[model samples]
Target: MQIQDLPYPDPGVPDAHSGPRFLWWLGRNQLGGQLKSLAWGLLHFTSVTGLPFCVGFAIQAVVDRSGARLALSGGLLALCGMLIALGDTFLHRAAVTNWITAAARVQQLLARKTAQLGSALTRRVAAGEIVAVSTGDVEKIGWFVEAVSRFTAAALSVVFVCVALVVYQPALGIVVAVGVPILALAVLPLLPRATRRADFQREKAGRATELASDTVAGLRVLRGIGGEELFLDRYRAASQEVRHAAVRSARMWALISGIQVLLPGLLLITVVWYGVGLARDDRITIGELVTVYSAVMLLSYPLRHFEEIAMAYSFSRPSAKRAARVLSLERATDTAGSLDASVPSGDMHDPATGLLVPAGRLTAVVCGDPDAAGRLAERLGGHAAEEASSDTSVRLGGVPLDELPLDSARTAVLVQDKDPVLLSGTLRELLDVPGSGDITPEEALAAAQCGDVLEALIQGSLDAADPMDARITERGRSLSGGQRQRLALARSLITDPEVLVLDEPTSAVDSHTEARIADGIRSLREGRTTVVFTSSPLLLDLADRVVLVHEGEVAAVGAHRELVHGEPRYRAVVTRETDEEAAASLGEVLDGGVVEGGLRDGVRDGGAAKHDPPKKDSHQSHGSKHGKPTLSDVLNELEEIEETA
Candidate 1:
């Protein structure tokens, strides 16, 4: 049958049934082409069978002194040879077309299923397994499907040849017919073992691919922590395991190959032995004996197909099962009712922590643990945790988050993550998310405090004209960390959802930039329900109110200043600049103490009453005299500490 006529297997069927059922389904769908190809192949096999008969006829004609019959038989044999060659060529062409089209259809189905699952696909299946299915599995499935037509044609040709032999010489024909089936069926028992080994080899290969992908993605982190050697050693071990599996698979195939060759050779020998006896007994003429022998020799070619089909199936079955598994992944769903036509209009609530973000107001979430804040954000955005006991329930307008239609829910509540994904695109294109409407690029950039980001774009020789059109590389690798974060923020602002949820939007920028972003966000997101999940003091101060999260629950809720004084955890979490800042501050305190001691020593040694002439000081004089030392002064003290050490 033509490959175009083959139907792709239904993805909903059980994987266990996919192998056999898929083959049957393909046959049923492409029956017309298959029958045509088979008919032509049979005619070719008949023409080939006539060759030996014509040769025998010529020999007998020469023996009987009939020159005309000998010449006619010779011409008939030549015509049969040409016809056989033509049939074989056409049959091969049709079969190959069948294979390629079937593979293409299956691949198309796989692509559709992948799109149907969308972002949820990776959560269900390993990315490497998906890669293996599309690249390796599709080809194997097509190989088997295409092999089916060729194999059938070959088997039919062998049958036609054997019948022609039996008609010419009964004794020789019976032997040839029985022996050919034996040769073809002999390899069936060995196939199970070969398929098992092949499955094991494919599994190992998939695992190695997964390990390699993971290694590449985390290579930067591995090098940063000096763990590259450790991961490389692990990958090396995985590679060795893959090699061992491949060797085992090859050994099984080798055994199958040996059987294919030996069985066919033995069948040829049996046919020759029987035909020689018949010729000596004078029951068959010398010419007929030669014809029978020739037919038996031709039958050996198709017998080899039996072994090839077996090997193709052995490799393809496991590949189909792997592809089936990926196609079978179900989309994620919430237990709550369907959310079609639901437009959330009130406060957003997180039941897990008793945190409520009132509608049309700016709210800041201050978490003692950033990890907890991140988890809260994920739940709020409708990404349900696999763990059953994760009792976090987020609601919009008093309706449970799980009840919302996935698309509508996502559109309504946009979660701009701390490390938001910056897909490869122009800056303007990145700002326009999936459902962004008429929001202007300039407004979005301004609201994000992206003036400096635009300046950088201008400085860089990007191919696009406008700063908005400047290309941002994959994952924003081309941009600095802060620039990427700001661009992500701009994208989020453009969406302008009913409830915009941002997790640490200003964490990467400088304090001045952070303040601007904080002010800009509040001004732009005027009437929407906005939840900023951050402990940044600048962002927190801009909020109408701050909710303090501790141990995955809301511990305190009030204004940012109120929480800072009342909640020590909130204060420690936000006010702690960094390790470098702490070290600098400690050095400054020590240096100040040394200076005070030096002044005290001078007073004691000079016998002064530790008094200085009071320089005409007003109310502002004392405050100015004892102003807090700047971070630069602290850094200088730290330099002294380092020098002394």
Candidate 2:
């Protein structure tokens, strides 16, 4: 593939069994580019080596004082200069092309893997590692790939020069050849130490990158909690650690460089000392001495490639391995069985939890454990978590979900995660997701109750009130939490899938706004399969059926109102209360009052309420023996603290 035709039509699956194998795979894929680079490199170095020969011949012509010979030598020198200029220019072009194409191919493979595995990939790999791989690691891999042909050509040129020297002067050539090998191989013994130091530097750098990424992601939260300086100090220490490791690595490399210069200088001195003796004895001409000396100087250039190749391999090997590991990951539900290609219009069932989402109904799942609910939501959409059992499965229309291809499964069932990402783009572009049809941006925005979101977008930009063309910053960071969440919901609703699974879609919104969204979703997806995972009362009340998951099992299935009255487990989980609290709150709940104790006086509907001051005996200590605070318990404590303040 040409460099311009980047992101290959099918970048093809990578051979990720090992780092070396992956490097081999990259070379094989871009053989054409490599060959072009090789040809240019050979031409460039050949011309460079010829320059010393031309100078030697020119000197001979001047000594003879022959006009014809001088003219011939000058012509040859000009030809060599032209070749050198042309070769240098083209060689650089070819080498850079190889670098860009190789990097692009690896990036394409990574992009495909990311899309194939989705959030599952992040669970298996650190986000920082992925970031490092895509940025710095890619360049190192490309550097090695681009260096291969140039190094080969440089070695070949050195060999050619040595052969020419031996043919020109036997005794001088012998001394020079022996010293060149020693100069190149003398540093090999020290490389292992250098590689170890380099590896440590890379590790520390990765840690620093991860720390910086986390700090940036949580900057808003850190500022709120007055912990920005704490994290900044930690990062400063990490940065210092990286610096120290890099300095250690650089010290080893500097030593290697010093040895390289010392050995070559000694070899050059020895060649000149011997050549000068040969000249005095009339065994070699002055022209021959100059040529031998020039050839030795030229050999130093190729010797540097040995060190470069070593350093490149040291850094790139681990990088390729990380990329390979990411590419090798497969979804837990990915199976080799033939896909059930026939699309079906029937109920979706989760055999593990015995929860069924009947066709043409809105279902809500309630669980005390938010983590469990999130896992169930994934399974419901045919995405098996890494930790989930392989034997456990979900089915749609009597066909096993694992039997269906990924694209088909996604088309049939779409899952909207709790923290859905709103990629940077215009509002219209964000809503214009893949496979979205018929539903206009306005329709989705309406269904998601996104009027306030549109207002926010309009106010942030110079665009018209339509807000479709308003730009969203990366991850929609400029928008409030509720605005981002609503925009994500709108994007999901626009897809109009056969089955929609949402996890806590309204968690960030107020109850009044959430009620509107629930109503809008019910109206828009009136006859579709919609499964919402949430414990919010507004959304639960809107579901056609509410399934209560207790202790990782389905404890009850009924209307939200019916379950509250019939099943104490359901009530306790929903209200986040103890069994005793749930029983005692029944009367107040029946009277339409809040589940927690009465609000402070004059607190209106949905208004924040102050908490009562805690008694010394009521204070919950860090070493308290009770279980971790439930959602209800946390909210109550927050209120109590607010009142005390």
Candidate 3:
């Protein structure tokens, strides 16, 4: 595959059995590219190996005083030089092409695996390992693949030079041929220890990379808890360990390099010693001795590739294995059935949890165990296991979810995970979802109660009022958790699918803001099939029906209020203790006069009547700058009112 045609329409199934096999598979897949590289490599090596022979021939012609022969030798020398130039240029191009295409193919395979596995990928592999594989591992794998042709050509040239020597002078040819293998094998015994050291280095580096990624991801939390120094020290230690391991591995390779130089130098001396004796005894011509000497010296260059190829294999073997392990993973769900002609659009049912979500109604699921809830949510969204078990299926519209085409299943249902990521882009781009849905981007944002989110974006950017055009940093890091959660919710709401499964949709927001979001969602999705997995009383109160998931199965189904009053377990799970505590918390908000007597129930009530609008103040005076009340301005106005009251 060419670099331009990347993301190969299909990277095709990888072998994935072992590293060597995987490498072979990669080579086989790019057979055409490999052949082109091999051809160029052969041309380059042949020209290099032929140069010494041309020089020896020139010396013979000069000694014979044959002018025509001298001219012929000069022409041949020029031809060799031209071939070398052409070969060098084309070889570079071919090697580069091979390297880039191989890397692209591996990258595509990894990307496909990531999409297929979703969040499960991290569960199976370390985030650092994945990152390392995608970056450094990919390059190493491509390097070995690109070196294969060069190594093969070098080996061939070594053999050809040895054969030419034997034809010219048998006594010296035997010594040269025998000594080359000795030089190549001298480093072989050291390779195993070297490989082990390299593996250790790679492992330590992966750990360091993982630590760095985790540290960056939690930097805000670390700062809040004053743990930044602790994490930094830990990362510093990990980096040191990686550095030590790398130095050790480098020492082993350096020893191998020293041997490569020493043995070849000794072998060249032996060949020259034998050739000089043959010339002195009149057993071989002086010109033949020069040819023998030149050939032996030329063979040293190709011999170096033998050691290089060994090193390449050693490094790339582990890299290929890691990449193969990642690519071999298949999604839990089976998507092989081509039965999309008709889909049963009815209530959604999960056999594992025995929870049924009736069509055209909002159902809330409350599970004591969040892990169980997440798993159930996965099944509900058609992410079933590969092998069907008794508890494996979730039926949507009376149809087995796994039977639907992958795309069809996705369009039919959308599960907004608890920690959805907001990719780096403007607000408009973030919300521009793909799939047929009736919900407009504006409608979804409003339904998720994202007024503050919009204001935060505008305040943090040059743009003021146009939230649609405001830029968001990667993963929405600039926003608070609540803001990020709300933005993710809005993105999901934009899809407006036939079935929406939300897992802890309001976990990050305050009770007041969550209440408003709950109210807005209910109103926006009045007639749609929506399932919310949350135990928040505010959200539970808004559901058309509440299902209590106990011990991994449905225990009761009823109205939120009825369950709260009648079921002690449900009450314990969904509500705080005693009315006194609830009353006391509300009293604290009012007595402290925190932000408009803390009557900011407009955040949850979904109505302006509950919380009066902030009176005009200095902050409000500048609100018209953005053609609207910026979120910060509204917040400041409320604080002013609270202080005055």
Query: For candidate 2, lDDT tens digit of each residue in 469-586?
Result: 8999999999877788889998888888888899988777655577689999999888989999987666777899999988778889988767766787877766556778666545
Displacement of residue 609 (Cα, Å) in model 1 is 40
The residue pairs that clash in candidate 1, if any, are 1-33, 1-34, 3-98
**Collision count of model 3:** 3
Give the whole-model CA lDDT for all candidates, comma-separated. 0.71, 0.79, 0.79
Clashing pairs in 2: 611-639, 611-640, 611-643
Find the 10 residues in a row with the least total lDDT in model 1. Answer: 603-612
Query: Candidate 1 versus the native: TM-score?
Result: 0.75
Ranked candidates, highest TM-score first? 2, 3, 1
**Residue-by-residue lDDT tens digits, candidate 3, 519-548:** 889988888899999876667778999999
Model 3 error, position 452 (Å) = 5.0
Judge candidate 1 against the unseen true structure and give its global Cα lDDT, from 0 to 1.
0.71
Model 3 local distance difference test score: 0.79
Q: TM-scores of the models, in the given order?
A: 0.75, 0.88, 0.84
Clashes of each: 3, 3, 3
**Candidate 3 residue spans exceeding 4 A from truth:** 221-237, 333-335, 338-344, 369-372, 384-390, 402-405, 451-467, 508-516, 578-645
Candidate 2, which segments miss by more than 4 Å at Cα?
Answer: 223-230, 340-344, 387-390, 436-438, 587-645
